[model samples]
Target: MNKILEASLKGEVLVIKTEGYLNKDLGQDIQDAAQEHIANGINHVLIDLEQSNIVNSIGASIIIELIEQLQETDGTLAFCNLAPIIEKTFKIMGLTKYCSCYSNENDAIEAMS
Candidate 1:
């Protein structure tokens, strides 16, 4: 299934909700949305992945790029509601070194704050 990406501003943070597969198109869509917010100086991000189950390499690469960009401005990107398999995949790929994972949005938001 095609991915659906939605982004919204919650005070100083940007909350991104994604569903379906995280493939090339969806990954790029996420990158663009986050980059636009970053350019505008809104840095903290919370990605809700409750509806997403799979993330291909392309999606992972885009996420890495977003992390790099956020790092440049001392910003943080947190992810929440990830499937166990996806969380393990991220850990195995070493993405956990750069980003944080949370069990839910509230935890992520509190931490980002």
Candidate 2:
């Protein structure tokens, strides 16, 4: 499937919602997009994955990188609308230990506040 990475500025938090497959290549795009916002003074980021179904290893790597970067700046990275499979993958990979997971984008936004 085609990869889609659309980003928006929501309040003080930068919201990036990913659709399609999140593979190694697209993963980099996700990182780049998030970085663009952080460069513009957005420390809190929320990635809404409700529309995403498949995420490869490369995507997971980039997600980890985003979490690390956010942490260094005393920022936060939250995830929402994750598929059960992807959620299991993240938990197995220990992402949940570092990043926060929400049931939906609204909850994620509220947490960002």
Candidate 3:
């Protein structure tokens, strides 16, 4: 299930939902999905990881790259439905400083909006 489950715009925010492991491929897919929106000035992004429970270093690195990409647009990246371990890992990787993690998509959307 290394794929994007869904991608749509909610207001001005681009919400990308992913499934399976957050590996390089899936990470790239997420980046690609958001790139167009970011380019068009939809800077706020919410990644719903309710189905993605594991991530490798490369995946995390790509997310870091995405954060950099968003910064160029003065945009932000947020995550929702992160597993406890995934949230801890992002914190340890210092990713939380660049982005935010919410318990669910609604919370993330509200906060981002």
lDDT of each: 0.86, 0.85, 0.92
Model 3 RMSD vs true structure: 0.7
lDDT of 2 by residue, 13-88 (tens): 7888877888887788788888888887789988888788888877898889989998889999888999999999
Query: Candidate order by TM-score, highest to lowest?
Result: 3, 1, 2
Q: How does each model score on TM-score? A: 0.94, 0.93, 0.97
TM-score of 1: 0.94
The residue ranges of model 1 lying beyond 4 angstroms of the native Cα positions read none
Segments of candidate 3 deviating more than 4 angstroms: none
Model 3: per-residue lDDT, tens digit, 33-101?
998888788999999999999998899899998999889878999999999999999999999999999
Count steric clashes of candidate 1.
Answer: 0
Q: What is the lDDT of residue 5 in candidate 3?
A: 92
Instruction: Please tell me which model should have the higher lDDT, number 2 or number 3.
Output: 3
Better of 1 and 3 by lDDT: 3
- Per lDDT, the best of the predicted structures is 3
- Per-candidate clashes come to 0, 0, 0
Ranking by lDDT: 3, 1, 2
